[model samples]
Target: MAKGKVAFVAHCLLNQNAKVAEFARLPGVVSPIIGKLREKDFIIEQLPCPEILAMGLTRWWTTRDIYDNPGYRRHCRNLAKFTADLIEDYYRRGFEIILVGLDGSPSSGVRYTGSSDPIWGGRPQATVDQYKIVPGKGIWIEELEKELQSRGIPFPRATGIPMDSQDFDMDKAVKEFEEFLGESSGVQG
Candidate 1:
């Protein structure tokens, strides 16, 4: 039976192995969040990790400005167009589409992104304290939105998994997502 509901999520949410070495909070999947979506009967789809796709597994940690370039944006646009095609197909079929992003990812953040001082250019810093999480969409998310807009598809309801918090607040993340899901109950595809 088709439930006509789909949730597109950041890759690392389902596979922590895909994240940067020091950033993997879980051993594998984020069961709490994924379980909630499963309970709601929404089919989950993992979006491709733009950083891994573009820079390979050995890539170092960086800020949004580092990835905010023509080449990276073009690569993201291509990925977005492909994903948007899938999104359009589901939309055409009248499925409810929801987006879940990594809150501080340079490539996939939906509502808040990671940024650092303008002087961050050369070598990777000795520490990550200089990074700050601020309100904004990441490169890949922006490209995806633009791709969807060009195709005349309204952006889907989106929420972020807040990984930027110092302690990785799982409770807060779940609460926010639960609230978003509750609010989206009345939304129609």
Candidate 2:
């Protein structure tokens, strides 16, 4: 069987300082899956929407930051709508696997909405003409990466991950990831 091609859809304006909070918002966005499908070749793309991430970061920022950026309020509204559209576009691409982590944006009842809580995440909403961000099992990124590495597939470098969230060493997050993707997987445990 041909190996699976996973395309990770990440938020734009990625910064390590905020990655921890971002990961906390959606814990298993990539890590767990990376650990599992070790043989799978993957292409992870940041959502490529700077306005959306900026808007979200605005909300997460301290009151001072919010106060500093008066346009922050408007950014949030426009960003919410932009995100919905962007997500729909990605979904329409018909990726075999699509992971959307709405880290900072809230549901406006327009685009697809996933839970802030990782445990109750993965909600698909109707937006695009045909595409739908359907709900599915939260992927085990670490295990997936481990499995992929064993297969010698190249894993995209993770730019922004939380520092203290996952069990694996934070500094080795990418290194371990590289190793994980080299491992092989057969038994579906």
TM-score of candidate 2 to 2 decimals: 0.31
Clashes of each: 0, 38
Best by TM-score: 1
**After superposition, candidate 1 runs with Cα above 4 Å error:** 1-3, 185-189
Q: 1-189 in candidate 2: lDDT tens per residue?
A: 313344444442233234423333333344453434444565454443333256444333121212223364444435434443443343345433434333222221112222232222134432222222223211222222334455443333222222222232444645644463455531121
- Local accuracy by lDDT, each model: 0.85, 0.34
How does residue 2 of candidate 2 score in lDDT? 15
Residue 57 lDDT, candidate 2, scale 0-100: 40
Write the residue-wise lDDT of candidate 1 on 43-131 in tens digits.
89989889999887788887888899999999999899889988888887778889999998888899999888654678666367777
All candidates: TM-score: 0.94, 0.31
Worst 10 residues of 2 by lDDT: 104-113
Residue pairs with clashing backbones, model 1: none
RMSD values, in order shown: 2.0, 14.7
